[model samples]
Target: MTQKSSVRQMIGFITDVTRWSLSGGIGYQLFLCLLVVFMMLGVFAYLVQWKLGLAVTHMSDIVSWGFYIANFTFLVGVAAAAVMLILPSYIFKDKDFHHVVIIGEVVAIGALVMSMTFVFVDLGRPLQGWHIIPIIGLFNWPSSLLTWDILVLNVYLVLNLSIPAYILYCHYNQVEPDPRKYRPFVFISIFWAFGIHLITAFLYEGLPARPFWNNPLMGPRFLASAFAAGPALITVLLVIIHNTTVFKIPKQTFNKLRLIIVISAIINLIMLFSEVFKEFYFPTHHSLSAEYLYFGLDGHNSLVPWIWTAISINIIGTLLLAFNPGKNKPMLLLPACILLFVGIWIEKGIGLIVPGLVPSPLGEVVSYAPSWVEISIALGILALGMFVVTMLLKPALIIEHRFKAEKPS
Candidate 1:
């Protein structure tokens, strides 16, 4: 193709993407509108936060991190979970996942976008976030896990975005993508996925002051829970796509994903149990953090109920996904996925971060709760992610429809 023709095609593709994104069913439009309202509210709340300062948040000098960082940590795991699908479809050559591997990539992109947004919103001086840039800012590269996290996350985002964009661009033009061009990147992405979450875990585990977070198993636990939560969300999203749109995902593919969710959830449970045993069995100074989390230390028990609720839901989700009855019933599967997703979010988001700080290294107890403004901002961040995912999926679905039209019966 000539350069002029290529430019014309690119412009045409953008036009189609915009049109398809705008054109959706009433239900879709309503959902989009709802998200916009939440986003606007979130923006208002963030402006208030920006105006007043972090003082508006429940975070004190002792409990410095709150809702934003919790979500950020959880989403890093969710973003890495895309590797679960990428491995089977790309490495194992599973034809069943070929059509939906793009879906996983899209999920990764959306999750990363949210993760970065949370990081952005958490900043007191949002403009100074650019300090992580290599040459312009003091990234503290060799010494800081956070610097490593910034590098891996942005690179992973680019890699995930590029692979699917290339695939969809080829499909948009009714041409087959060359594996030679994109397959190597797919391989690199698999390792990069692990690196992104590992670096995130190190960000916590390397903190010598927080003994609760300085566990050797933090990385493994993060990976296991990430695989469970990530695949569980993808499963729910796939079902929504299957029901609401013309896109058809095979039951065999669903079954494969179900297996991944089941195994990962089990591994995550085992790790959780192992931590409980380690914490409660010997009972050291470090045990106070876990004690405060699970059963409450002294008179403080703010997190006890939330932690147990997370555990109950996780157990229920694991059992539901493991059984034949739940596997066969779509209704049961959907709720199980929700339970697992919510359970992990609660566990990792608030449950993981708060305990480490509650019983400070100096043994001072300070309770932290997200104020209304913090909650509003979180809802807004989530709404923004859903909007992006919804927009991205529309274009991809349109391209899929075009493929179906061209396919020979």
Candidate 2:
């Protein structure tokens, strides 16, 4: 536990985590290759889209939102989820998640990068995305949600990931951690985590013309689903890592995440039902967005199928997690998490994209299916996120293992 030994340990851990993310075992290497290959295809696809315009995808004026936006929204929810783990451990002093907190941060960083990338690609001219930068005259602080989104996304990303990294790093290295000296940094992270997704949800909800996005309840609903899925992902990941490595997730911590999954899952379901009731109770054209989701309306049958799928998966997933939790087998939990992940993906993807198309901006339906190019590019981003998480966690975990090993028996 001497300073030099601690520093060496810290360096080793950081290097390991870094290696796992970008370069690691054969599996990690293959993952990196997969990510690179997909991204290359995405770049090629984008070039084609730019050359021919976004028409390469099914995007039309009627269906302005598409694959990129759907992924962006869902990943924002994914990224925001890290807070559920971090807050409990740090603020609430819930030590159950102490082990998983750093991994949560790593996942947050990966997911956020993907979300931002989607925003980047979704732009008409990707390079001009810097138009939101203050030095540029294009920034309309008072008028543009784009400006706010730019500000919140970057700031929150840094805040959410940095503190846990700094703390875990210092602890691993046996350094003073001294984040206690920067308490405001931790405080800001909590609120910032919440804000990033709120702003993201607002990015959609703020749109007055798009009735689907206009629901005032959308922001909170975004948060509920995020918390539900975020920790569940971490739980599944913790298990996977345990299987692959000597490290074992503490039963206490695992149980904690199980509790979190259940609580957040129920809350998410309740919010969905609330929105549905409000929309269906009154039942008007303004409610057509939610209606279209539950049951097909007009001629747009594309999302009707997915909407029911999302509802069933989410409802079932939530119930299982809520009741069974620690009692269920890990394999059972895996499916639950998978189901939740799929359910959210469908909800965000369909809810954001196709609904915007229905009734259009001017009251018309449009046929909107993501073309192969769009699907490929979207999957490429996802594959990249998974690849990044796999890489980063491998190194970060080694650091943790060394620390735990060095601990007194």
Candidate achieving the largest TM-score: 1
Candidate 1: which pairs clash? none
Residues 1-409, candidate 1: write the lDDT tens digits: 9999999999999999999998888988899899999999999999999999988888888888999999999999989999999998988999878778888888898899999999988888987877878888787987989889989999999999999999899999988889999999999999999999999999999998898999989999999999999999999999999888888888888888888999999999999999999998999988899999988877888888898999999999989988848554679989999999999999999999999897976798866789988999999999998888888988998897787689675
Query: Which stretches of model 2 miss by more than 4 angstroms?
Result: 1-23, 168-172
Q: Report the error of model 2 at residue 294, Å.
A: 2.6
lDDT computed for candidate 2: 0.78
Give TM-scores for every candidate, taking all chains together and pairing residue i with residue i.
0.98, 0.91
Model 2 steric clash pairs:
16-395, 17-395, 17-396, 20-391, 21-391, 21-392
**RMSD in Å for all candidates:** 1.1, 3.0
Scored by CA lDDT, what does every candidate get? 0.91, 0.78
Candidate 1 global Cα RMSD? 1.1
Residue 214 in model 2: lDDT: 86
